[model samples]
Target: MKLAWLRSLESAHQDCVWACTWVPATDRSGGLLLTGSLDETVKLWNPEDLSVVRTNTGHCLGVVSVAAHPSGRIAASASMDSFIRVFDVESNNTIATLEAPPSEVWQMQFDPRGTTLAVAGGSSASVKLWDTAEWKLVSTLSIPRPEGAKPSDKGSSKKFVLSVAWSPSGRQLACGSMDGSISVFDVQRAKFLHHLEGHTMPVRSLAYSPLDPRVLVSGSDDECIHMYDAEGKTLFSSMSGHSSWVLSVDVSPDGAAIASGSSDRTVRLWDPKMRAAVQTMTNHTDQVWGVKFEAVGGGARGSLLASVSDDKSISLYNYS
Candidate 1:
């Protein structure tokens, strides 16, 4: 494994950077990096030098999630205000605004085919799907209440969804919740299939391995990263080393390793099989909130990892 510091941007935002995703390359542009933050802005960055390309502002509260469309020309962001904003990537024009009352929004993703946008509905214990073309509410995949549960019990909020991911094949959806439960859904049927169990704290971030639809990874406040066999319904491995809450985790595009940012103020590179942190980056002075590997193609080899922290900084690294 090889790593090199690329660039660091001080004051990337006034607060925590909550989410990051790689925008696929397009004819009119090279690839871009999209990030959402507690500053209430979704920013587009030129990946080459990590320069600010544009800042899309509209969300009334902290922007918690940002996802790029598979086509690269569109993106969506959701805020704590329970609203999802779909926008044009190049022009920064709002395409549509979606909401589900009594439910807060956390993480979101655009389907691999770009046909739908999935938003994790916090408190509502469901995932909301929006039609990409018509920009209309498409479906609500709700987690069924546990057996013998009371309607007024606070346990309902335990299903507060916090993160969502789409498999590379676009056939499935997996969402992590505050209660540490992960729900897998059948996208074609818009149905909640089953739950994956492991963590006991809030699961803040999750991702599916690009090479295997059955493999899923998650980061949680429990300071552990979990590897699950989604199809097998079994926990494959658990990685623990971060001194604080693990805020986010992302698999390299090649699926060779995993990268994670944590409240421990460090970014870690892990070997999935070893289930141990192979490297630690301690350049950030505060809690690290987001980490992602740049997508494949775009004239780039190896991989690029971007990390944002409570230190109000963004740091880029070259992974080889």
Candidate 2:
């Protein structure tokens, strides 16, 4: 693996940077980077120089998730307020607002076809699907309460959905919950499939390999990252080394490596087959919350990685 330090932005966020994503390249703009933070703002950056393009405000609580539509024209952000804001990516204008009661919002993703948006519902113990065309909620795919559990039991909070992912084909959805369980759903039928179990701590982040719909990666409060065969229902491997909570995990666009950020103030690069952390970047002064690989684009050959930390900074790295 090849790596290089690019640049670091101090005070990129007032609090923690909780999420990051690469917006696909468009004719009018080079690929952009989108990030959300506990500061209650979503920011857009020009990836080449790590310059701020826009700062979107309105989220009542921490902004937890930012997802770009496949068209590169729109994006959505979900916050602790349990609201989803759909907006024009280029203009930063609000297109729609989706709200669900009591259930908090964590992670979100747009389907490959951009026909729908899936959001992980926190305490609500469900994933909310919205129609892209009308910007209206279409369904709530809930995780069933555990067997023999009392209705008044706070186990529902444990089932809080934290991260959501869409398979490459957009036919399936997988969401990681606070209880350390991952639920798979058939998107077309809006039916719950099966749960993938292994992690005993909260699964904070998740990603599906771009090349394989069956491959899923997850990071957890257990300080380990897990690789799973979603369709096969198998736990392929677990990589442990982070000294604190593994705040986020993302697969490289090339599908060859996985990157993770941790509360241990380190960013790690892992080789799946070896099931080990190949590199640990210790440039952040506080807990690192988000890590993501840049999508390919203009003047961008090797992959670019962005990390946000509790120190209120964002760092960019070159991964070739």
Candidate 3:
């Protein structure tokens, strides 16, 4: 299998595009592409022609993450300023604005059921979950501090969270931190389960396999991609090829393959069964920041992959 380049938008964003997601097709509209950039704007695009449908401007700092509700009627975007704006997709009207003081926001995701939002709480050393109905701070799944640490180290910087992922069942949440620790939490009980460890540097991105909730994939600044059995708390395999930090990673819709983008300026496709990188695409000039698989209603769109980078562009590919 290979990634066939379909098209690319040069300067899709005025500055670095940090995050991207597909707003699933609802009765009112088809699947649309949502992207957040260092330009401080969130832009929605048509999948057919790559034309801008809307440009949302409110974030004062670079938007760090964007997540769409499963129903596609609502979406949320978070910026470096620790604010999350939950808005209506078609009307562009604000549903709610959420912020946890002193806790910087990084990656965010709506639960598969769309009833809760899980946010990576940087510096706060926790995963913040907000309920959708009332948009209230429902739970804080804080990462446990290291053993033997001093009492003075409360809110320790070593565990600052940078990425999070909800299992397909929505019963569990995993968060990656600055200290290369990934914490697993039981969502139902709001309990900390365990940590999966290996990478020595920060882990910046994570995803759970759609086919198996226990299978998790992560990319780290240590230049490695790891597959883990999250429930068993074990690392299955580690693939290394990128010469720099592996910035982003995602499992394909079928859960048979993994795709990753890295600071090494390349996008790679890896086969979990082979435990090796099968293909690499040199499509960006600078560091690649985000890589995502379009998970719209199965047959409406082909297997598609989107990658954003420090090069200020977006590239779409056919994952066949």
Best by the lDDT measure: 3
Per-residue alpha-carbon lDDT of candidate 1 for residues 84-181, written as tens digits (9 for 90 to 100): 88899999999888875643777788888999888888888888888899988889898765444378754556778888999889999999988788
**Model 1, position 29: C-alpha lDDT score:** 89
| Tens-digit per-residue lDDT, 1-320, candidate 2 | 75577999999888888788888878998788898998999999997788999999979889878899998999988887878889998889999988867447778889999999988877888898899999988999988754444787656578888888899999999999887888889989989888888898899998999988899999999988999999998999999999999999988877889999998999999999888989989999998888989866444557899998888888999987
Per-residue error at 10 for model 3, in Å? 0.7
Task: Please count the clashing residue pairs in each candidate, in the order shown.
Answer: 0, 0, 0
User: Model 3: which ten-residue window has the lowest total lDDT?
Assistant: 295-304
For candidate 1, the C-alpha RMSD (Å) to the true structure equals 1.9
Model 2 bad stretches (over 4 Å): 145-155, 297-300
Candidate 3 off by > 4 Å: 146-155, 296-301
Candidate 2 residue pairs in clash (backbone atoms < 3 Å): none
TM-score of 2: 0.94
Candidate 3 vs. truth: CA RMSD? 1.6
TM-score for each of the candidates: 0.94, 0.94, 0.96
